[model samples]
Target chain A: MGKYRPGRRALTGATIVAAASLGLAACSSSGSDDSPSDGASAAGGSDVELRLAWWGSDSRHSATQEVIDAFEEANSGITVVGEFSDWGGYWDKLATATAGGNAPDVIQMDQLYLASYAEREVLSNLADYSALDMSHLGDSVLGMGQVDGAQYAMPISTTSFTLLVNQDVLDELGLTLPDTDAWTWDELGEFASSVTEASSGDVVGIGPMNNEYSLQLWARQHGEALFTDGNVSISEDGLASYFQLALDWAQSGAGAPADQYSEQAALTLDQSDFATGKQAMSFTQSTQIAAYTTASNGANLVPVKIPTEDANATPYAYLKPGMYWSLSSQSKHPEEAAQLIDFLVNDPAATSIIGTERGLPANPDTVEQLSGNLSPEETKAVEYTETLDPILGDAPEIVPNGASDTDPLIQRYLLEVMFEQSSPADAAASFISELQSSIDAA
Target chain B: MSLKELNALAANRSARRRSGGKADTRDNRAALGFLSPWMLGIVGITLGPLLYSLYLSFTNYNLLQSPSWVGLDNYERMFGDERLHQALKVTFTYVIVSVPLQLAVALGLALALDRGMRGLAFYRSAFYLPSLLGGSVAIAVLWRLVFGASGLFNVILGLIGIESSQSWISNPDTALWTIILLHVWTFGSPMVIFLAGLRQIPRAYYEAAATDGANVWWRFRHITMPLLTPIVFFNVVLAIINSFSNFTQAYVVSGGTGGPADSTLFYTLYLYQEGFGNFRMGYAAAMAWLLVLIIGAVTAINFWLSKRWVHYDD
Candidate 1:
């Protein structure tokens, strides 16, 4: 009887533990109902503590943290707590927090979600942010933060899709560097093949992740927009050409072997075989170039423009803001937050401290103020931009509502093709059908 | 009978009854007091949101806009969605292979460590440490590095005169298996449970079997096997539940794509990608409910089967 009593007690104990565990996990996993986005506040002059959330690598985190510290030091009344994570978990955590009504006061907004967040009314409109004299900022960069005639976020520094080359690999093959301004794919492919042949199995010619976005640069250079008004705009032949180039590189031992494509399919620019010197070339953004340069011995790296499909093809390089910062509508201190953003964007001291870390400064005045303090690599990148004369495209259209969800569906098809299991014909068909179905459902 | 004897007997009976009733009341109050935090938590948090999600599972919830009731529309869509089918296939394969393999290895390890060895705690802790970090971001990242095409594993093979081009985690044929191996490697938690079960068996049973001239194998077959059945059942149930719901490892290892054509797409990862990544919260809610049902049914089946085989010695 006594034993049975203890067992009954144990069951009660187990129930308690289970309930508590569930509560804690639930709280951790979801957004707070009390989050300020919808505008409810407990009565108090109690000093406000706001969380500022972002995703970045260590350097960005540290630099942003320093800037936050400066903001706090200058504005003694408000305390800002920063919440950060790497890219993989950032959105999940952010969404969970947002749902729970515990969203951060200031959010680092990706272009992909800027429109979605705005449409959902989760983001505060920044119509008055323009009043801060951001006219000094690059209009091209600022354009990305605008969606449907409303500004939901302020433009941060800007970057463009660019290419990185291994100069040592080029030299080893007795090949001169391709002219950044006038290079074509046939010229580059021949150079790539020569480099691969000379490396004697030590290096491959190129390594691109199985991403449609990476191919968009070349597609854009041919004056083909990857998507237009909810439809894929690139021709079937264009996709075939893109895949064929990748297949040719693989077959010629100038790129990752077919079996190894999966390994490289999902890599960030940092872990790319090119960055680690396992390959000769990689396509990425100017922001990502910093990672590749820092990861490799500096002597062999060079920033170059992505080549055009043909001689007459435009050297299309879309320069746009990498991300944006926005004050939440729920924030009681929007005025103060706006002031901090202005300081971060246009102040000479903050610009110098931040440098091109966020990318090139979006503020034209800040760019002018900070140019003297730019690192050699950053300066080289800025100089390389002028030489490419890239045909600037419009800011990627606000990734349409639910398009963020559908982007990976497209990538999956591309990956299947790249790994040699599927033809581009089958891949494109499946991708278009799948995405269309999803879009229709949405 | 004498008056004193009669008085003593009456007093003893009354004392016994009073004590029993008092203990019952005390236990009732104490149990409620101890459970106050949990009762509050469940009503305020778990039960509240779980019921809300149950409502959402039936709705057309985009999460950005308020959820609208859609009467099984989400469930209906799931059957037609190829991604959901693919996710189910991947998740089932992961659970079916990883759970049993993990238990088998854990049981083998527990048997090996049953001997009271020197520095036992150190060995136990060393073996158990991976379980602590089994779901961590670092381990997932390490999994990528070790299984990468030009990684330490391939480099080691090259040193031993073997040519290999296997990027195990990224290879569609092999990515799922790499994740299974990672799941199996964290068998320490179950091993510890098995160790506690081992200590509960009476030494006399083995001794008596030995006196019957039974060898070590026979003794173990008769003694240890039956004695550990309950714990084995417990571990199997727990492991299957844990394995079926794995997310972080797959999420991180696959770079949140669940790629190589969704080969490493565990069920929970798919749910998360749908819910959070795609913002198909209603569809994701449906997936989550399905997971709960599947896990619950499997566990119930396990318990029913355990009644036949799990010997709990009195």
Candidate 2:
């Protein structure tokens, strides 16, 4: 018995040591899979492979992959790999990758984050890449990507903040569409209230308008910028008016109750009040009109100019980049990256594959070429954008660092005012102070 | 009781001890070999990151830039940050309210299920299902749908003529409560533990109390309560620790913003937002360490207080 005990112990010890080593080996094997290719790509060679990353829906993924395939075919020596994720997880993954010094060669950029990444030197300066073409892109649109006179990103497409109206709901209520071209904010509010009164609450006239983008447009209509000179520049009075209009609309029975309004504010695009056929009008960017239309099951969704305080004054509507494509500063093959970006923007065959998924193409020639194949909704977006071309104001300055962090504060303050938890004046003051402090901290 | 028996026991113990010396070394080697996987994981994955985070807490380490030492700046910044305070308040309120309510439900259900009855296994498994799914993202999404403005809860309230028009999950005043209820609904694990504790109590004790003329309430108070204290204490400690770190439900329900006026911002969720959303990893590390300290202090207090009420069979 004693001899067997010692033998069993020896066997167990040997088995356990073998198992431990195997476990560690399993972990190391999984980690090393990506390092070889990653190391090879970082060592820049004539035969270069690039990692391109973006965030979008399944359709966008397939189309972008097609574009990548075309780019790889055109430049036989360069291979491009696609890394994509949904918008929700994209930023977190990008931040981790960038921190690890393994960022993709090309990244999809957003205006809200352009300054932050550019200032950190995580993005490469596009002006250094002579292979990239920019003459076809408008200066105003391209300027959105510039920080301190260096172009760090190039705009791929543009979207304008517009009012989306569910015309089916309006028609069901026997109400004619209000003339948005000359409508004032008060006029819009009254028309909305009338629709709600006519429908007897089966439908709300409008959903809440408390988002930062809508507030920015509201401030812009009053000749105020959301941010200027690296600080929040919207006046307290301007903010108060902005909140007060939504409050008045809520009180007048044009908008959802404060509780439902807040709920709708937090909903996804497909679940919004207008998309669910519970509201006649909602504010959205032109790029969102298609999603709203699809959600409403082919309802007659129309986009119109946002109402202004004075229609004769400088137009408040501005063309904003849907997103930008920028090269990473860590890329080993910046020239190859530049060639890919140029191909995406200038090659008609590639743009055709991209279609209107990113938004209307930023290039006028690409827009014209893609116009012939647009879906009805896409065509409507194109026509809507062109109509505003004659009167659109200059785009606001690039959003400052830490600006995205202010979104929750804005939502909180908006709800506080709407629910009468705080006065509009007080909410405005608090928002301004908090926003400035956040920006200052950044 | 007898000196002879006592001496025999001592001799047996010494004989075993002498032999154990040699076997002990061999046993330890085998045991450590078996434990190597977990030890390696702890050292490489857990402890490595934990110590790195402690070092990072003293620096200004935004993800994109190299960390620069800032001494206590990250900790100092917490004093003036209202959002940090709000997150703390929300987390404490949630933990304070949730842990007790969840244990009560767990203990109550456990007592009821402890009786030897037909289909007991079926009922046990059925009740345990929710706890299995409680921390999942799908459950969090279901929670949002259940408490949405035009959701099942409000729909039922309307049917009952309660006249509630508010979205329970989005309203600042009640959003946290919905999440607390989600925590309470997942009381199955503690219930199962309490069941085991209840079964450990001798059935003869209850019969003796009955013969001594104790009523149902009296029997429960005298026989059950004292005997179940250890399990209750175990459940309370675990529930408090789990509640303090609640994140997935709040993150999914709040859409990762801890929104509707930040009413549902758990501490860990706020830490994630700072680390990932704002890219302030140093500040997030500081917050993470603060949470560890807070949990440790609370647990120490619990252990100290347990002596007054907790009872052991021996």
Candidate 3:
């Protein structure tokens, strides 16, 4: 065969050279921005530029912007630069920034990324930010932000993957709401089926998102979790049960069919069958309700506690401190940066504007101050959560370093089982074995 | 002659020679200077990463950790990795099935349109448009809508009383074919190439064959077939490369899982899952190298076989 034309080859060659230069530049810039100086002391609260980055939905974006503006106005010496993106792109951007060592001064970290970040030494230990006082934050919320023995970031608020109910749907279908606080899997299935049948297919009872929330809930219920130090904690039986529910729903048409799911998956939640009023209930986090509510425009939504199998098998939800405000280990103005973070999380005015946009406030004082100001739905969610507070389980170890990579693998096996190509037992066994090995190697 | 007169004559001759050669030499050097930038890039950029990746393929280097020398272990591991096998099987099946079917349809459409149709350019552009956007996320998303249970496809099927399984995307058996059909639908590029090749075929050859009482089928078999062989060969090679590298559509449609029992688990998607998603960069690098070798070997075979069928008019 003839060789590639010289002109085309040369163009390709030049393009590669340019790309390499850009990559090298990106990698090198981080080192210069982060890391401590050899002899210079931390900068005073002068005209310091502090970069703050976070990921959130539109509501969080607006509220956070307002908080940032108030913080900047109150602290004239500090310049807070904000960067934000949706959840999907946030991690990839953070990882690359961490690798470069030029991470943001005040970063928003989730439990999913906290351990990995701490392990990689990308975040400054917030315990070192001596200027900021966090004595007022709740232990349950503050506890998650700690890595190893040292605190790396301050938890802003505590959130969980709670279930949102359409109370109107239940009322219309003439079915009483299941005891979500400690309902078993069998009870949930029956309730959903009855609702669907009674409505003549006008409503599909529940839309279970085959995501981390479901897996986490299922894992905890079975007396295990997704990860234990270096290996999987959930038993094969637990995984089989998880896949079985998803499959049974699809098979019985209690949820969207598999083919329909594949197609509907192409669209976002806003364009999904549920959003279009074809489905009644959906499993989601309390934070996600803001978007659903705005889209549904108050369609009789209610936040329910995650259903559990029994008292012994009580569902243990996570208080994801709505991510954390972390300092880059390489900042020149570490003190001022810490001050900026202190204002964002602890200051009353900033908290008021931010409201529960982050989540139910982790600060007891802030929660108390905003009690009467909350929307009816927000008040209900907060009350529901407080009632279930005593049942809250201990937080697991920070998500393992390779934790982010396992979702697709889990989804693959789950999909296989859903389509009946692989039996639940076999898929569960294969998934656990393969994923453990993969995580261990990583 | 005087000594001064002799020196002046020698200096004049040397100055004249220098002036004459300088312009020509400078022109030659200028041409080389323009070309050197490109030549340097080939060695430093293109070949540099190429060789570095090859070296990395033999090591255990995750993006976070330092690379450890592992000899051929990384490559050897591919033989045992179940996901790798599945991805390769899916990728090869896609290439083998989709490429030929797409090319045939493209050629057929090109031939049909060559019959002096009105607004031919409009039709050609309309047909060519899908190829430009076939691999994009939007199309992948649209593909989901068209084939979803509540999708347009199901609605159409329902009208005719043909009930379909709701798990189109979730069904392993049909997921791969759905992707294949999408690949086939983007026949615009190859069709345009075929049309171009058909135009280059001499009209006189067809007339001469007609004079020999050759029917349309015979004329096409003898005249059109041999002449279009070069384009056919080009299309096949290109299709194989493209199908092997297919990522965006599958990634978007499947949410990067390549799911439904791994039926749509393309090689690149699997590699991404292993590397970025799983943080198994070392394994991913090894997988990438294996894919290169496979694609290289397949292309080599295609070249070897082309001598038998590919013909050039020149």
Candidate 4:
């Protein structure tokens, strides 16, 4: 005990401090460390080794492993080595690997970097591959992965922007929220203020505007497209109104405190305002109820239609592909890669393992199969996704090629407004120009 | 050696080379043979990238495309780039404020630990612990937890009747300071160096001064300070250059957005964001060159100004 006691507690202190940064250092270097001669092998031979990389959660990783196991059992001779990363560092790893021509066989693609990677020809066009199958998926689902009429990726799931109501917070306060389906943004704000008042400032109504989706939805509501025809089309006024809602909420005591909001902006889901039970509601993706349920310390959250200006607008929301599977242009085994992706999206055995972990499956057939057996939180995600089908407008435009940099830009302006360093109008004006230039440059 | 001594040695080497022919030539050939691997490594790995990046600094390369020549365009943009200016300002503040404070703390600790005391190894390793872990992402996350709203920091504040719930690391006014504090907290490496310098200082001078009725302050000022100037200069140069290159601490601490409003936007973090995050490799290269120039100029100034105050035995 004495020998162990010397380092036992001291090691814990050092371990806690040295942990997270090494993960990133390892990830950034892995691209260079991997065999540069990758993808030059596995030419339709038995026991083909393929690398499949994606950014996701622990649950998603396990589910993906299960899918891979199922796929391997069903189709022998092909092996998939999985590469996973958190979302923050994923693109850096993917881009560096893809640029070095050592990209994994199957690459998980995001809408932000999708067009850029597609235009760069780093992703293989699925249309040219005969082994791939997308016939079961609808035209919209197919179009989600198309850039300028070329299918470069296969959409895995569909999701919509939504308002997640934390029933546990309301129950704790002995209060009820307003009708989420037809409420206006202002009415939502008022309810938030009431929650703040009832809880004596312990909790707020809505979380901070850290993510980009809320702003996009607001722009569309005001008859502006965030990006149209490869350019930023949202007006300064439309954007300011979005920022204004955030500022107004903070000042009105209907939102998380400015510092708390800013802090929450960069925190993990488990530490988020809504997840930590410090907020009654959150504007997030429809598929998030499952994740939020887990993140929120036993907070029973329900995903519902987001509040609008009039509430009667058809397509009060818009659906977007949650993620896509892009076959690497460098992949020597594109046929095998496509078969694996096809299995993940359309096959019942794979869908059973996946459930709503990656949002509702893009294929209607898989979505139907998942509905009866999903976990309660996953069911909430599927049910909420179903409720949006009638009201959701045409699938939103794919993020522009160069607009991947705009997320940080949006957060910057959002912070500026929240901090009172800049007015909403001023921040919006700067953001618009910056956004336009980045898109133009890209 | 001083610059004058270095020049004299070079002159001496050349004279020896001119007079002593065969034996020197044989030695040179052997030296070249021994140096071949390192020369190859430098050329292949280090020098190649350095020269390529210098060329890339003038082009418009985004890692995905052919680097089109756009002479001075990247440099021209850096002049007007507000975010780049902000990043420069943040980096300069971090270096200026943290380096002296860090040196002072390191010097203080080194002096205190210089005295033979009980459990010296334990104390030394414990103090050196933060230096090892401070720059890591885990420590930054733990830092956030410590200074978070309703975190231990606020709880400590509460105990002293200072009622506040602001997350120190998240507040724009205080975020930079928190990072600077982290920088200062990693004084272990410098402290160890200072301790080594202290050990190298002879006790004869202090003993002589003590016999002359000199006080601790007088002895430290006249004898110890002069002897330690070289180490102090070395530490200053290293610390300044290191502070400029610091990325991980700020990148991880600020969650890579350089926020609560670009307050912790260290220059290397910005360069990394441009090169890797934004994929503007050309601009990043230009920024990297600019950083090299800044560090070079500052180091040159340090060497030039060292003539006035840096003491040497010669």
Candidate 5:
């Protein structure tokens, strides 16, 4: 019995060991199998496959995939794999990829992060590739990509920050849209209050001002910039007035109440108070007029210039780069990557497929070609851009490395003031100090 | 005849021992073979990253560029970081408030369910459903719908003529409490543990106590409570750890910014913001290690204190 016991135990142990080893082997072997395919594709060998990644909606993704198919058809050897996600997930995934030294060959970049990536040298200089066409892009638009005199990204499109007004809400309240072109900040506040009072508070006159872009425009109107040469340059007084304006609007019942405003602020684009016709007006990017109009269920959403303190003297608008296409510094086939970007910019077929999903194309030829096919909302945005071209202020300086931190800091302070946890002056002071420290740390 | 049989038995034992050594060696090899996968996982997946993060905590790794050694700078920065203090305070408040409330609810339900009842399995599953779905993003989204300005809660209030327009989750004063309520709603796991612990308390003890004229509360206090201490300790430790590391509900409800003035900024969420949002991975790694140490210390204290209050039948 003792002799048999030892043998049985040994056999049982062997079986368990063999089973576990096989399980682990199965896991590791499968993992390793995936790496070689990625490695081979990234090596720019005979196949010359490239991975391109971007963040956008479903329509944008389908449009971009169509463009990729076209690129692949034109250059048979070069197959471009598309990776896309919504806005929030994109940055995290990109950061992880870049950290692991496995970033996609081509990437969609944002202005807020343009300088950050450029300073980190994660982006390859587009100027280094003469094969890519830059002659089609004008200096002002092209300059958006220049950091320290090296072009690390190329502008895909341009958009301006604007006020989107819901005409239906105004009509319901028996109020006409205010004159956006000549209205001062004070007059705008009164106009919002008048609408709210006229509507008996069923509809708010405006949503809360939570956007940092609005603050930037306000600062620019006061002859200051949010950031200058990599440090926060907006003064405390400028920031305080901006906060005070929002506070006054809220207190006067022009904007949604603080708690309701925060709830609205937390919602997605389609769920916004303005989009749902709960508010008559909200700050929005010009490129988003189409989306807002759609979300509003055919409500007459119109794009108007942001109201300024003095529109004639202080031109607070600029043609901001909607987004940029960049090549990763770790890309193996940068020349091919540049060629694809050039195609995306210059090819009318590709532009037709992309079709202002990214906003108006940066290339003038593509814009002119697509002029006859513009949606009514797109036409309004284009005309608005044309009117502002002569009067727009200088583009704000490229955002600094730590500018991402500023958005949350601004939101926190905005909430603090709205909740009466702190006075506007105190919140503004705290915001400036925190923003400065963030920038300094970067 | 007896002596010769005993001698033969001894000889057989000695022979078996000599051969058993060889079998033991084989068994050891087999056992090692089975353990190899788990050992490999520990070394490759867990230990590898843990050690790397420990090293990263001492360096200036920004996820974009190669790390540079900056010994103790990241840790030192935590001492002066106001946001860190805010996150810590928020997490502790959440833990302190949610743990006891959850355990009490769990224990109450557990005791009631311990009474013999009809459809016991169905009730158990129904009660356990919230815990199954507690940390999910869907529940968080549903929470927003239930607590928004025009949400179900306000609608109910309106029907009763209360006429309030406050967005409960967005109000700074009430936002953290909304999350805590969500935490307390998921008491199923601890309730199940408590139910099992109650069953283990000898029914005969209660019977004897009844003879002594003890009421339901009195019997529960002396007999059931004493026996359930170990389970309560287990639940408390787990509840504290879970609350400290909670991220999904807070992240989803606050729209990933921990907003309305950072009121719901759980420590894990703040660490995530620093690591992923701000790209300050080194600082985040330090925060991660600090969280680990805090949880570890708390758990150790819990165990040490368990000796006094936790009763064991054996």
Candidate 6:
């Protein structure tokens, strides 16, 4: 202990990098001492402990646990250990676990990170697991979980992005939505103005929609993509105006003031401007309509298609998975994990327990079966997506490898533009360049 | 008597040497046994990861895949990365502004407490409370709520007929200042140290100066200031280093986005965002090592400056 051996220390230091990486590679080889146990469980009908992880609220957790209990009861040879966290902590924990070679068997995946994980080969090919029944899920829905034309994950539920209008807010202000079915950004702005003026500035019309999804829709409405063919294709000027929309609203008193809007960015869903009746409309995933309704004390929120300025553009809206069930490539029990996923998606027992909690069912038959069981808001959310199916846009290629950073990247520039720290053109240029570099680096 | 003591010490040194020193050998083994737990932690837990991260700095190591060597690419990117520069600017401003202000508040409080006042212990503990919690996520969250729009600060301003709805923590121009204020609020640790240093100053110095018709200001300037120089220097160096590495307060206040246009992006938080948020572990590792170098250089500068102002009895 007292002796100094710099050479030995350096040698050990070098081996650590090798050894640490070797540990990850070794996880796949199944050569570690614990592999025998993991392998035996996978290879045989021996009782297997399949660890499932997800992120959700308390209601979702209780429902998921209830379903897990039913699944365990049905499958005698398997016991599922369900671990859950809030949304923010879930990804970090998953990444850390995957890196440490201790990832769960089944993971609730988000579309934003699906490609990132799949491209990195952390997720198993869904095709390899034959027990999972996904035939009822159409190609468009399945494509959302695909990378390089191969399914790497399964969509748990389908959700579409929509602009939600608070009918109650409009009713209180003694105003009406102006033919919202096929509105433009100008119409959106005008409607917001009418609400603000009608309410004497007590209730702003819309909260900030300068986020990634809003920008994506805006780009698609112009027949482009912020991410095109694995690159950011939107020009700086186009990007500028997208950000400038929120700033215009902020200045025109159609949206919350700059400070208030930015502060509201940090708030939880229930405390958001729309939820608090401070904004007449806001953008959200259709799946969140139920959550918003609950948060706003049943505001009678209605989902409206995203607005477009150009008459010639294609449908800019697409259904995204509420979350996906992905099998970890490092899982010792891939078959059992697939079985669980199939059960969760297909079994009436599981569906009845989970009833639109994860979102409306991803499969057509399951949706039909659960239509009667859905909560009032869930039925509306499901019905809204169903009505828009014919007009939904072509699914985007699974987002690029580094596209998971879209939210924070877009958010930073959104704030910069709104605060006038940088002109919209400059902010757009910076954002595009930054996003491009990240994509290229990835 | 001194000659005998010197002989005894020499004989003891000889006995402690490695010539048939069985007792000393046993003592060494016992010493090693005592240190084994800590030694294992230092090597396996600390050094292993430390060296791994150093190696990772030179590689493209995303957590999803094994790292491949990228040489100086990550390090080279730092010079061109504008966001890194902003993070550096924020960190430098925070350390520069907050440390001096915090030390001043701590010193003032320490001096105030130095007087033999009623319930000195109570005041000391009360002042020290914030230091214990200042870096905690809970207090940082509370800080966010307190400075948010329509928060207590704005509500208080309204009471005085000065209406404001500005969210101090969300505005980029004022965001870093709120964090600086959070840093300054944790003056207790330095205050306690200053209190101890104040006690070390002999009361006789003040008495002697007073007898010579020195006023309170003169006594404080001549007797107290010189004696407190070492403590002041210590606090300055520590505060600078601590504030430079500050993360929790900014992280919590910014909601982990470092936002309102990246104003509150501490270097550590930026590194975390790069490493975990974007999966740019290699770049993040390089950033972390750079932070170490930056903190090292700053501390060295502080030590160098200390030579000019530090007063020691020797």
Best by DockQ: 1
Error of 4 at A197 (Å): 2.7
Where is model 5 chain B poorest over a 10-residue stretch in terms of lDDT? B305-314
> Candidate 2, after superposition: displacement of residue A398 in Å?
0.5
Which of candidates 4 and 5 is the stronger one according to lDDT? 5
Output the better candidate (3/6) by TM-score.
6
DockQ, candidate 3, vs. native dimer: 0.23
Looking only at chain A, give the TM-score of model 2 against the true structure.
0.84
DockQ-superior candidate, 1 or 4: 1
Query: Which parts of model 4 are misplaced by more than 4 Å?
Result: A1-31, A36-45, B1-26, B117-119
For model 1 the local lDDT of residue A395 reads 53
Q: What is the lDDT of residue A321 in candidate 2?
A: 80
Q: Output the TM-score of candidate 3.
A: 0.85
DockQ of each: 0.37, 0.26, 0.23, 0.22, 0.31, 0.26
Write model 6 residue lDDT over B149-208, tens digit each, in one string. Answer: 868988999999998989998898998999999999999998998998788787878888
lDDT of each: 0.73, 0.82, 0.73, 0.81, 0.82, 0.82
Off by over 4 Å in 6: A1-45, B1-22
Angstrom error of the Cα, residue A221, model 3: value is 3.0
RMSD of each: 5.3, 6.4, 7.6, 7.5, 6.5, 6.8
Task: Give per-residue CA lDDT, model 3, range B93-133, as digits (tens).
Answer: 99999999999999999999888799999999999988988
Model 6: lDDT to the true structure? 0.82
CA-based DockQ, model 1: 0.37
Clashes of each: 11, 0, 8, 0, 1, 0
lDDT of 1 by residue, A1-442 (tens): 1331223244334434443353335222443455443222336444556667888766677877888788788766556678898765788777766665567778888776776677778777776754345676555556778777777888887776677787776776676766766677677677777777777767777754345456566567667766677555667776666666776777777676765766765665566578677788877666655556766756467777777656465546666567788777656666666777776777676777777777777777877886776777778667765555546656556555556554476557656776777887777676666655555555
Give the worst 10-residue stretch by lDDT in candidate 4 chain B: B305-314
A374-433: candidate 6 lDDT, tens digit per residue: 887788888888778656787666568887888878888888888899999999898888
Positional deviation of A415 in candidate 1, in angstroms? Answer: 2.9
lDDT of 5 by residue, A1-442 (tens): 1231123344334433443343223122111112214435344456776889999755678889999999999987788989998776788778878877788899999988888788988999899898789899899888988888899899999988888888888888888876777787777778888888998888888765666677778788898998887888889899888788778888999898888888865666778788888888888788787777777888988777777766677677777888999999989888899999988888888998876778878888989998999888888878877877756878888778877666667778888888888898898888888877776766
